[model samples]
Target chain A: AQTVTQSQPEMSVQEAETVTLSCTYDTSESDYYLFWYKQPPSRQMILVIRQEAYKQQNATENRFSVNFQKAAKSFSLKISDSQLGDAAMYFCAYRNSRTFGNKLVFGAGTILRVKS
Target chain B: NAGVTQTPKFRVLKTGQSMTLLCAQDMNHEYMYWYRQDPGMGLRLIHYSVGEGTTAKGEVPDGYNVSRLKKQNFLLGLESAAPSQTSVYFCASEGTGQETQYFGPGTRLLVL
Candidate 1:
């Protein structure tokens, strides 16, 4: 079974600054996908970004980017020019590519606080 | 279009009570999933369906049941609710080969 871990339960970043949220996973399969999802106080889950294990280049979306290290089994999310809207609970997820199973395994989550 | 919608955005159930939570998607997606979110637990899959009339158990299916009679709708049921079942439930759907799974607003369930 694959499991994702977000060691930091809470993270704080000043507005307009950059912050990195750590995420690590345990999976024996070489082919897999990693994702970061954000949940605001509204409790709405939003997909921030995703990275494919086979892709060496990290994935970027607007101000959100990922640092995917396959060999180290680490996938972290970096938010640049952080805004107050970035405050939320961030979750890391994993999915296997071999079975093409749509099921996702998620981490406990990290609460991100953006200070003005 | 309403990507995914869940019925009774908020629900309260007493132990031994039975209720069904509805999830409808207008994207005509072939895959639908049910998950519950709790404090200290990000989200856990409860059930999923590949297509109409096909339902499968997920990680935490012990206390839940699901049905997919129509391609656009998936129903999750709780036969005998418990306090442990109190949590927010989310419904998600994705295309056959699509990587992104669209999520619903979510239903908050409180069982006493």
Candidate 2:
């Protein structure tokens, strides 16, 4: 079984600043995928970014990027030029290979607050 | 496109009552999943379907039943709702391989 852990329960960042959310996982499988999802007050979960375990390079999507250390089993999300709209619950997820398509094991989300 | 949609956005049920939540997707996805989100506890997979008429148990399938009579729709039923079952439910669909999952807006259920 794979377990994802988000140590921070809540985080706050000043507007226009940068913030990093930490995530770690336990998985014995070598081939997998890591993902970051955002859940706003609207209760809609949206994908923010993704990283393939085989790729040594980190994944970046506009202002959202990840620091993936496969050896350490760590995948952290970084948000740059953070805005008020970035305030949401951020989740770190892990998915095994093809046998399970997108069945993600998510961490207890980190509630992000953007302060003006 | 409406993407993924779950019916009855909000519902309140008394203990022992039974209800089914419906999830539908228009993306022609072959895989559908049911998950429950609780405060402090991340999303837990309840059940999933590989395709039409094929339902499989996930991490937490207790007290929950699911059916995918049609490819576009997956229904999750709770027989005898309990207070422990009170949580927000999210339905997701995805294509084969490692494609990203598209999630529904979610259904908020409160068991009294």
Question: What TM-scores do the predictions have?
Answer: 0.98, 0.98
lDDT for predicted candidate 1 compared with the true structure:
0.93
lDDT of 1 by residue, A3-88 (tens): 99999999999999999999999999998889999999999899999898999999999999999999999999999999999999
**Docking band of candidate 1:** medium
Interface RMSD of 2: 1.1
How do the residues A1-116 of candidate 2 rate in per-residue lDDT, one tens digit apiece? 79999999999999999999999999999999999999999989999999999999999999999999999999999999999999999999999875855589999999999999
Best by lDDT: 2
Clashes of each: 0, 0
Please give the lDDT score at residue A28 for candidate 1. Answer: 93
